[model samples]
Target: MRRRDVDTAVRHAALTFGAAIALMPLLWMVSASFMAPGEASTLPLRALPRRPTLEHYATLFTRLDLARHFLNSVVVTLAATLGSLLVTSLAGYGFAKLRFRGRDAMFRALALALVVPGQVGMLPLFLLLRELGLVNSYLGAMLPFFGSVYAIFLIRQYALSVPDDLLDAARIDGAGELRIFATIVLPLIKPILVTLAAYTFMAAWNDFLWPLIILSDSAKYTLPVALASLVGEHVQDTELMMAGAVVTVLPALGVFLAIQRHYVRGIMAGSVKG
Candidate 1:
């Protein structure tokens, strides 16, 4: 082959191999989830289940109350994502567009605070929640994330592109600040908003440590916490665990896939501006 053709062939081969390697674990998880109980660990490791069954999934819903934890995960993720988006977007827009004393300094301080690890404040936050009687509640699990430093930064970066003349015109027309934000700023920033929503939803859905610490009751456990507890009690049930993994991962994957175009655009916009 010519040199250019050979190079193209090599690159294509490398990409295909890398893709296969990356997908192997996910394929195994899905396969094992369909295997009969104890079939996954037989003398010979089977790449595919000999007799595919939905028994593990049935067990998860019936015995483990997976449905309740699934609902809990959905509720907490949606609430945290929407709440953070609204709060961060409004704050970001105000900082970026509205002139106020000390605004730049405050925004700079908030940006700097992002460097501090969230875990550093866990103990104090937990104690405060306990004092407020918010522990063991979904609100407690989601409270810390209602205002995210990163979300504010992302929204601010996007909101900076909005024209000051638009706001000035709206004000001159007797539009209130909140009304302009609702009708003008929000609609203009829809792509970044969707991107932020997807990101926050994924983070909240996959969060393990905070929810585990705050939610004392099993009934309120999110998917990751519930899956951990399930694994502890049913270590040998590989099929069941795989099924649970599938359930936990699918929603976040779906959400990301659905909004991936906007997410990519938002990231590119922020990077170019920054």
Candidate 2:
């Protein structure tokens, strides 16, 4: 074979191996979810179940009340994602396009905040939420994610690539800032927004710590928190735990898979344009 062709073959082989290695655990989790009780922990470690069963899943929905937790995850993740996109996009556009006093200073201050560990602020934030009587509420669980500094910075960087002249022309034609943003700016920055949506969705969906801390009500628990509770209750029930894992992972995985193309395109576009 030609040298280039030989090199391409090696690279593809390496990538395939790496991909398989990365996916092995997820594949095993799915396979084990279908396994009968005690089958997953068997001596030989079977990749495929000896006998498939839906009993675990049924138990999760019925006895364990996982459906309620799943619904809570869906509601919180969607709300947080939408709110993040709106707030970040608007703030980013204002920073990138609109000139105002102290704008650069404010942006710099926010950028400095990116270096601070999120956990450092959690205690103070929780106390503030308690003062406002927001603790143990969905709003409290979602408040932290609604407008992150990193997300705002990402949007700002991407927004800088938008043409200033286009916005100026809109202003001359009697278009208000909000109208221009809705009609022109949003569509132009759609790729980045979709990327942000994917990021926010996954973050909110998989979040365990904050939700566990804020939501005192068991009925209001998100999937990860509920799954952790499952671990405590069903520690020896490996198959049951796997089933809950599958349930918790599938929606975020599906959302990412569905939007993966747009997600990649957005990242590349930002890297180049920003």
Candidate 3:
């Protein structure tokens, strides 16, 4: 091959190797999840199951009650995602479209909030949740995600590009702010909403630390926390842990893959407007 052709071929080969290396752990997790209880940890370290079985999954659902944990994850993730969308979109649109004194200053202050670690507020947050009787509740798990500065920034940048004339025309026709938001602003911002939804959903789904702190009841534990529980309980069961990891990760992975095109477009669109 010519030097140019050789370089191109080498780059493709390097990329393929990098892809395989990145995917190896996930591949092993799936493979190990299918192996019999003791097979994956055996001498020689089998990469694939000799006889794949569903018993690990069966055990997780039936005996361990991971179904409940899965449901908890779904509930918290959906609630957080929808709540984040509603709140962040409204805040973003308002900040972008509406005029008020010190609005820019107020937004800058909120942006500065991103630098503060969430753990810094844990004590007060816990105390507040206790007072509101929201501890150990799904709503408690979701409340923190109801709005986010990054989400607002993204939507604000996108909303800035929306035509002022359209909103003014709607107002001239006597449409209320809520009505315009519902009918006009939302449709114009659907791509960014989907992007935000996917992000919020995945973050909520994978969350562990906050859920562990807020939820005292075993029944309220999200999947990641539950899987951590499984680690302590089934310390020797590699297959079971892998199964739990798969269960925890699959939905978030699926959602991201489903709307990745919209997510990418919204991101690019936001970048251009920004």
lDDT leader: 1
- After TM-score superposition, the amount by which residue 160's alpha carbon in candidate 1 deviates from its true location, in angstroms, is 1.3
Q: What are the candidates' C-alpha RMSDs?
A: 1.3, 2.2, 1.8
Q: Write the per-residue lDDT of candidate 3 for residues 1-274, one digit (tens) a residue.
A: 7999999999999999999999999999999999998998899988889999999999999999999998998889998988899999999999999888999999989888877878799889999999999999999999999868888988998899999999999999999999999999999998789888877777788888899999989988998898888899898999999998888777777877898887677667656744
Worst 10 residues of 2 by lDDT: 265-274
In the predicted model 3, the residue pairs found to clash are: none
lDDT tens readout by residue for model 1, 197-264? 87787789999999999999999999999999999999988899999999887878787888888767
What do the candidate models score in CA lDDT, each in turn? 0.91, 0.89, 0.89
Per-model tally of clashing residue pairs: 0, 0, 0
**After best superposition, candidate 1 residue 70: deviation in angstroms?**
0.3
What value does the lDDT take at residue 251 in candidate 3? 71
Model 2, range 1-274, lDDT digits (tens) per residue? Answer: 9999999999999999999999999999999999999998889889899888999999999999999998999999999989888899999889988889999999999888887878888889999999999999999999999878877888888889999999999999999999999999999988778888887888888888899999988999999998898799799999999999999888778888898887676567556733
Model 2 whole-model lDDT (C-alpha atoms): 0.89
Which window of ten consecutive residues has the lowest lDDT sum in model 1? 265-274
For model 1, the stretches where C-alpha displacement exceeds 4 angstroms are 266-274
Model 1, residue pairs in steric clash: none
For residue 5, what is the lDDT in candidate 3? 98
Error of 2 at 195 (Å): 1.5
After superposing candidate 2, which stretches have Cα over 4 Å from the reference? 1-13, 265-274
